[model samples]
Target: MEPTLPMPAAPSSIHFHANCTPTNYSTSPPNSWPPFPLAPAREISSYLNHSRHLSKSKPLPSLASSSQPRTLCFVAMEKKFVEEAGCCYYGGDVDVDGEGRATALRPAALSRPHTQAFHLAWLSLFACFFAAFAAPPILPALRPALVLSPSDSSAAAVASLAATLVGRLAMGPACDILGPRRASGAASLACALALALAAVFASSPRGFLALRFAAGLSLANFVANQHWMSRIFAPSAVGLANAVAAGWANVGSAAAQVVMPVAYDAVALRLGVPVTVAWRVTYLLPCALLVTTGLAVLAFPYDDLEGNRSAAAAAGGGNRSNTLWAVVRGGVGDYRAWVLGLTYGYCYGVELIMENVAAEFFGRRFRLPMEAAGAAAACFGAMNAAARPAGGVASDEVARRFGMRGRLWALWAVQTAGAALCVLVGRMGAAESPSLAATMAAMVACAAFVQAASGLTFGIVPFVSKRSLGVVSGMTASGGALGAIVTNRLFFSGSRYTVEEAISCTGITSLICTLPVALIYFPRQGGMFCGPSATVDDDDNDDGDVGANDDYMLLK
Candidate 1:
């Protein structure tokens, strides 16, 4: 037989409902019973024992038959404030919300979709970077084979940057239409085709210039790379995700510098192939790498956490051209985007110049062999492995303490310091200069500062306008190309300035560009060294209705 316990008498017309919970009970009147909140089993048992004793001491009369029964129900309160408290190994370090987007960067956990997207994004970009810059390391052999003049070489460099500028601008809207996965993969494949053709047809100055221009379309992958990270990670972690992905991808340029010359020697010397034919054969390797990585990127899933992208596109009027126009129009209208673009031009622009000219400069200035010069330049690109991510980490840490204003201050400070270091690099590069060892040390320091500044620039990008992230990224990225073009035309291409003089001018331009950071402001979080304005609408603030004390939540 079932054991029976002493029961409290119910009030007249009262009925208990089995489907009730604590949430409704807490909000109900005194007569309603409750669903227990989640707690330890022992604590619940103790409370039940006390309730049983109270019922025995204070029994009530039974319900009357003539009165209608009233139903009472309740539910346990939903926990709205659960914090992330899990390990990265088990995928807990990243806070995955209901929709599966991560709130923290857990790069070591690549088995998960978010982290997998991060890997694919960077790897594809790495292939593109390698293929795009591979020509420079072999330029010594290449220039002689093509019988190119210095003017032709510089014009080729400018052409590459110009093509990349246009490509980046177009890629932003393409990402909005097709998703980052498809956009990036397509770009890689297209540029691989260009690279392969360059191997076969780059016999004349015009052909080399055209092929270089076409190959530069590869760098447009940068837009997809940053946009992908921003969408997969939460606002709190987006900056670091962007930095780490791009930083690691940037290492491809360094790898190209080291690998291409070695490959050339192996093909030309060890294999007994003609030097010209060997360089052409070496080009095939990067093309193959690009093709493989691009297809791999396409094989991965598109992490569109929201419903179907096609559905979203349909909802936006089912016209891709209109959507593209709207996205670019809205993105360009933001003054902050323009400011960021100019700033990006100087820092990233200077970095581009270094990647192109570093090997050549070292070879020409110090009379080093091709292998030795390439090694020195590789060090600059290698810093992207840690220095860029360090900048993002610094930005995140400062924003946690001082809000958005803190991030801007950190960006300005580092960029200014980096520009000053660029001037120092010029001083060290004099006609009768210090030892190569000392010059290399200074170059490494300047590279770290410049790359870190690039990282810091993107740290502020996600917060600019979440709705137009791709376009804004494109604008900023294209700015780097434009800055390279102008700098190359004025300082690098002609006989106007020596390489050292050009570098100093580049540094000064970067310093002036850093001034625009003062114009970038978040309504609730304010600008650098300023409080929130009283009259501006904060529609762009993703962390809604944040209090002074709650700014940390946004950073987290």
Candidate 2:
């Protein structure tokens, strides 16, 4: 007889089912993947037989409709990925004879929303980074009038921190119950009230403390803001949205630094309003903005996760009943969330100190009076406004080309360089009264790096979560709050005017700790770096819902 093909062992067991456990599936036609250009038509066409001619407008049959394993893989990849992955998951295994290749007999989850909620979430999250000025940077202008020491003025700082913690803890669960829409309204209402109260009761320290706490508690609007933004946009648009938000947040910070001071001076210089009265400007404007945002969102028609639904409808629409606790508990246990949170906290702590207490640091270190130092400190504050967007843009382009692997490494390297340079900026400005231009330039550079780092820090978040942007942001911001607590101590706030020591002590420390964190969390590349990227494939459905990558990326 002519040479015969070798026989291979059959599967331990086999059975045909009416439907897969998870859901129905359609018979995938040949060359089913769109464009037909990315993949050869013959390979897929042969697998589907003649079913490939179905019209594009026709509703796709569910995987549940298919009886064959190959058809189901093509039709129900999203649902079957995890829902059908039972412990005894395998139904069949292809064991090829000597020269033939083997293939898995089990279903696998599909990858979608590669950068979905991330970009949108980043913008809203970045806004918090900048909005912090209403609470922190503005507090200093009130000090001279309040007759409080610069160090003790941090009381408003501490209250806001505590309130922010409250807002975060509360808003997260609220997002689950109230939905993003309700939560945003409630949070903004609170924020507006808090700011108004602070401004109205400018003369009362006790009232001021209470309002500061309220403002912190009110910021929960931010979480809901992020969720809403993420829900509205598609995956591909995520990077750009986040980049813009990152830039705007710095703008908010810059506005706080530069504008608030001028406003304060307006009342003090023009109207004989002392620091307390001048500080009213800081408290009033945020209140107006909060109320306006709250009202506007309430009036608009809301749609969370409506984009690119045709590719994956089931995953795109938001579940009316999804809870925030589900998101938090699900992600808090995640290792990646914690690791990224660490990096955020470390770098953010430094940034917060610069934005909030730099006036004091500059005042004490150089013995410049409070207002002048506060004025000059705007250099960092202003640089941050422009630098953050640039960072986001840079990160976007880099990630698109080299993938997350190259982008993350670059982010850390830049941060490390910037932090080290802070030392130089400080040393140059320390002890000596250099030309005003040089001193301002150094301060601007420091600020630029600070804001630039702010943008870069958020750049990694897309790689962190697929389904749980709210939770991930919460964890990172919460950690950042804790970091703020540590750095806000009196010793760190000492207004000694030596630029070099402050830079070495503050700037360098932030760099050292965050660098390691950036390295650790960055997606691993080719065994060189280990990241969740291995688990997250490049298959964006453009839908709001996440698929398999949700599990791995959510926590770790």
Candidate 3:
């Protein structure tokens, strides 16, 4: 006497199979189908509507026994089907196209999370770069007030790089644990506070150096910035997106070089404020901007649109801490990561060294005024605007034709050319009668190549290991700091060499570092001169634990 529910026939495409066989079909009474428990009414309606659309005239077969088992089986199959075919966000499955990423980038589409994440990532790093480099442009004023010697200035640069190195190492694992959104935002806010303290309390050389070290922690945001882009964008567009974000952020350093000096001039000269007080006040601009953008990063976008780590418990059924340690170990153990780190050291490390010393170099060697020297230095960092993006775009373009090998070739070619240019610029400085115009011209070209090399270096980073993406990013970024520390300590610190001599030595080191690019090879993707293995396994997931739900999300 159990009442049965009438159901339309299932389409040929819908298959319902399970382990349990029905006990009785002919003996089952009419009007006796069991209702599916916990299935929402709207979902059942949707399924019926879909069934009706597939077949209008076919009469549906009755259930054997109005049993709960059969009803549950149908619901399970439906849930699985929706998960595979339907696009989802947050904890659900990602969009299906590019593995949870959009195929194209739309910078102007601020309403979308994909685009919003991109803007927040770059802007946060941009603010951090500004704060970290702000002091270099106004070093003339700072040195006089704080009684800092040339050695102390060099030590300050070393201190900052060392702090940044530690921070980068820690942030990589933190990004994997807490997500890039929290990791980057917290670092930015902390560095902003340090900048504020430096502006107010840094009256002596030691205090200035300590605060500079603290502020340098902001640069650790670079690891998260790259990690965020890699997670959000598809492999096809990831290179350009990473390059564009980092390149735009780097312009902040150039902006600091120019803006701080101009702001100092406006306050000290026009307003008749003391030079010391004007420089102190100038620090507030970057400090406030850092706080603003840091909060924006935390507030706006989803932690990761694909939620790769959201279901950490289910991936291999391992504990979260064990997984984290595994990823760190995997990233650290990889020889290729070390090679990329060394190569990154020369390109990005040289860029950092330039940001700290270029203004001083121009002022002392060329006899330019403070503002003019800062402006010239700004030119070097400014090349990042286009030069870096060109490197990334070139990597993506060549990659389409040549796979991973093409990316390696592009990086080697561009980086080698950049190293040669660095040597040329140093020789120009060593000229008996250095022509300012000609030197500036050569420096501009050198900047273009050097910045492009940075872009090209990252172009290969993402492919190294998807599972330890953040850790690899951190290792690579920290290497840049280590390179700066070594190069600065050896050539520039304690008046070990003339500025021109240091520049030449640094260029030579860069050339030596570029040789390692040949050693990096991917098993499935091939290498600089090798082809992929003939029996390649497409299901290889050796790098990291990518969630099944972490697929592409196409933006409308």
Candidate 4:
């Protein structure tokens, strides 16, 4: 006879069904049985019969036996019974089955407010990006209307990007200090006001530049968008969630490229308006959209790290400046954050440059018609709809498979491929009979890889420092703007180097950046930088009394 094992206490979090049926059992004598607190005698008999069948040739081992074979047999039987019964034995935290098969865990349904908050965050970003990039599509109309020189027009084109860099630098800390909801609404309102002013009285080139620079502040909305998504989604799903929010918002730039021309034509043809009037009026559509999104953000419920309003208020109320400084100091001090930021600068920075230059580059390199070159250039922007999200999905898959290391690996792999594609594009540009089709294909491929790299870079941003997610995201985003500035200077600086040489330089720079990315080491259990020490108080309270009170409240 087998010794009776003591019944293990059931975890309170698990719910066992009262109507659970026992497995069919043959009429065989059992040796030993483990005690189950709630299981009926017939259920115990069924488990014993199953275990006996599993150990067919070898007799059942006594539970008290010191033999290795007997211990292995006992564990195997217990595991088998657990699997057959479909009981979750590892509390409710684990998502694996008893047989060691990985089970997909379904996320809890989101509350209505949470759902609305998420949609609002993305829509706000979309409106901001739409307004910020609106200048590029309307540049042609503006050039003739404002009597802008080529240099003035060039400056106008990059005004938003330059302004966005400053905005991101400022707004990152703002989002951390103020909640995402408030920050997003404020940014939208500012952008809408800038656009409205430009539409009503933007007669001079200088006026247009000033208005665009101010409107470019809307780009800061990206930081808030990521912060809000991080608060809403779990770490496992945050990558994809961030990707979706960013990817869709990014589509606004492409939408502007498409919509601006159509809107420009529609106003002129339908209303018999002059080309200048049509161009100025088209800005109103995005302006109205921006105002609506801003109001939505203001009206919607705000989400915080803890997803509790009282907790968020308590955390955000006092020491707001201290919290902002702490977040900035921590983000800046981390070497991994800097490396990621520079890497992002290369991928996304180059993307910004390409957006403005692609049409010109294709037009000059292949001797294509202006319209054809513009169409080819537009292809790169259009790929954002699918490519950016794909990068996030890939990062999630790699992280799921290999943890933190896998995320970095995915970023490096995509960036490396993107660099190679960049070189291919440059070489194609110099070919004797460069096929427009071939050049466009390489350009699209390059865009996809770069945008995907941007997605992967952000995939690690929120993980670097949860408390400083806004700062980290902002710094990384600013890297893209810096990269665009550098690349644009290289291409347009009127040096002896040809455009192909400049293009190849970007690829080479990207390759050099990949080395540092490989060296970044994230802890297995703690935050990205050091270990547990890297994790600071999420709510920055310098006072010990308040910290204690917050801890007590959280526990309660």
Candidate maximizing lDDT = 3
Which of 1 and 3 is ahead in lDDT? 3
The CA lDDT at 71 in model 1 is 28
lDDT of 4 at 137: 59
- Stretches of model 3 off by over 4 angstroms after superposition: 1-98, 307-322, 543-556
What is the alpha-carbon lDDT of model 2 when measured against the actual structure?
0.50
What would the per-residue lDDT of candidate 1 be over residues 252-272, giving only the tens digit for each residue? Answer: 999999999999999999999
> Candidate 2 — worst ten consecutive residues by lDDT sum?
97-106
Using TM-score, give the best candidate's number.
3
Give per-residue CA lDDT, model 2, range 1-556, as digits (tens).
1111111221212212222222223323234332111112122222323222322223334444344432122222211111111111111222111111111111121112212222333333333433456544455455555555544566777777767656765665455444566666656766677667666775656666666676666545555654444443333333444545545544555565655566666777898866655666646666666666666555433323222221112223355423444455555656766766666655555666666666656666567764576666666666654676666656566765665665566567666666666666666656456455675676666666655665665655644554556666667656666666665552355565333565566666667666555445433332116645566454542133344333222211
Model 4 per-residue lDDT tens digits across residues 85-137: 32311222222222221122222423333345566777788888777666665
RMSD of each: 11.4, 13.3, 10.2, 11.9
> Residue 8, candidate 3: how far off, in angstroms?
13
What is the C-alpha RMSD, rounded to one decimal, of candidate 4? 11.9
Tell me the lDDT of candidate 3. 0.75
Worst 10 residues of 3 by lDDT: 87-96
Model 1 scores a TM of 0.80
Candidate 3: TM-score? 0.81
